[model samples]
Target: MKLTIERAALLKSLAHVQSVVERRTTIPILSNVKLEGRSGRLSLNATDMDLDIAETVPADISQPGATTAPAHTFYDIVRKLPEGSQVEIEFKPDDGQMTLRSGRSKFSLSCLPVEDFPVLSGGEFPFSFTLTSSELKALIDRTRFAISTEETRYYLNGIYLHAATGSDGAMLRAVATDGHRLARAEVTMPEGASGMPGIIIPRKTVAEVRKLIDETDGEITVSLSETKLKFAFADAELTSKLIDGTFPDYERVIPTDNDKVLDVDCKSFAQAVDRVSAISTEKSRAIKLSIERGTATLSASSPESGSAVEEIEATYDSTPLEIGFNSRYLLDILSQVEGETARFAMADAASPTVVREVADSSAIYVLMPMRV
Candidate 1:
């Protein structure tokens, strides 16, 4: 393959595809990025068996061919090149090397046969829909923080995406949980999205897709089948194998009869928690929130570290209650609250506390209390 592409363009595409390549892999081909130059475009593809990414950038193609090269090495070479430099790539099949030239620098990288690269089959995607970048970002940003990192419960390691009925009408929802905390976010269901089976999008795929969202404001086409999911961006595509497991009935964990309501300024509450948690034990990271008529005090103590207490103004009408929580988890949920006020509905110190923005009903968070 012989093609000339601008350094900026090539680097941008490489940045997207190279991340999908696993740094350590048993298969040599899996560590390389497949480069195809044809029809005035250079397509870059990289995969780690379970997740795959393909990106295309404009190029002047003199010879239409394909080859695989070390993904990280190629990316680093192009990245260090001067801006506005023209990158010329040539593959010599006989030598099994890909030559890259830019400015006064030249490098030859060993190439693997293109035939050895694995191709993730594009299965039939029966349900496809479009979501504006902003909408997609909200869904991911709100819930992904709670995605489980535990390997045993594979089902909880991804965001559960499905269509559900809400108070307003049909909605497309994303829910994630790690047993200790849960996050749920939804948007109005887009066209052709209803009746689709719920799918668990793996944590890695969710993160990669989120990064792509930062690059464009255009709509993203999301298409899925039973076993796979694909997110099509303006200039790139991400296909991933969905986690094969059944998500628990999350609604059962969401409390419905929480009588105590505490409304606190999101910023103040977060700041107080951060300050008091400085004294929390490293293992538990526990902090207690004592809520009374119109104020809340956050406190943390440990055998080694001294105790800390910070009072923040709050609006609570219920009887005084003290709840213990993981300071890190509480702050994570608080950071997702977009509104100025964060409303916490609690039954008692022992039950799950539901947190949500006072003005936004589309996103909700649930945190399990810990014994202080």
Candidate 2:
């Protein structure tokens, strides 16, 4: 196969697909990217068994053929080439080798047969829908921080996406939790999403799809089956195997009868937690929130380090309440709040606290209290 492509365009596509290729692979062909040229375009595909990414770029097709080359090596070579330079790639049919030429630089790379590369089958996806880039980004950004890293509860390692009925009727919701904290966000459900089955999208796939969506403003087409899901954008398509497990029912954990309500500036609350947690111990990075009539004080103390206290004005009408929570969890939820103020609904020091954006009710966060 022989093709000529602009360096910038090739690099951009390679940068997107190569990330799916792991640094180390048990199978040699899995480490290489499949390059195919035909019909005036060149496509690059990389996969790590579970996740696969395919990206295409405009190119002059000199010969219609395909080959598999080292993903990282080819990316590195093209990345270092002079900007705006045209890249010529030629692969011999009989000999498994690829020659990359740019200006005066020429390198021959060993390649594997294109047939050896594994192709993730585009399984039967019965459910499909189109979502705006902005909406998809919001769902991911709000809930991804709470994904669990512990391998014991493998079901909680990804974001749970399902359809549910809210005050506004049917909605497409995404929820993630790590036992201590939970984040739930929703967007208006499209016509076809009303009875969609719940699916747990792996953490890595969530991150990759998020990156792909940020690169373009075009709408993303999502197709989901029982075992696999696919996301198709302008010039790229990502396929990932769904986690084979059930996500816990998250509704039971959300606090419903919390009577105490405290409204504080999201930025100020986050800053107070940041400053006070500086003196908190490594094992328990807890910050205590003491709310009274109209003020809130954040305090943190460690046996080895001194204590820190910061007071912020807030609108609180309930009786005085003191609660402790992980400083990092608080910061994560606060960062997702779009409005200036954050509403914290509390029942007691022992129960989970519900947090919501004061101006928007579509997103909610539940944080479990930690002992101080």
> Could you say which candidate leads in lDDT?
1
lDDT of predicted model 2: 0.93
Q: What is the lDDT of residue 12 in candidate 1?
A: 93
User: Lowest summed-lDDT stretch of 10 residues in model 2?
Assistant: 188-197
Which lDDT value does model 1 have at 233? Answer: 94
Candidate 2 local lDDT, 221-289, one digit each (tens): 888988999999999999999999999989999989999999998998898889999999988899999
RMSD of 1: 0.8
- Residue lDDT tens for model 1, 237-276: 9999999999999999999999999999999889889999
Candidate 2 clashing pairs, residues 3+ apart or interchain = none
Off by over 4 Å in 2: none
lDDT of each: 0.95, 0.93
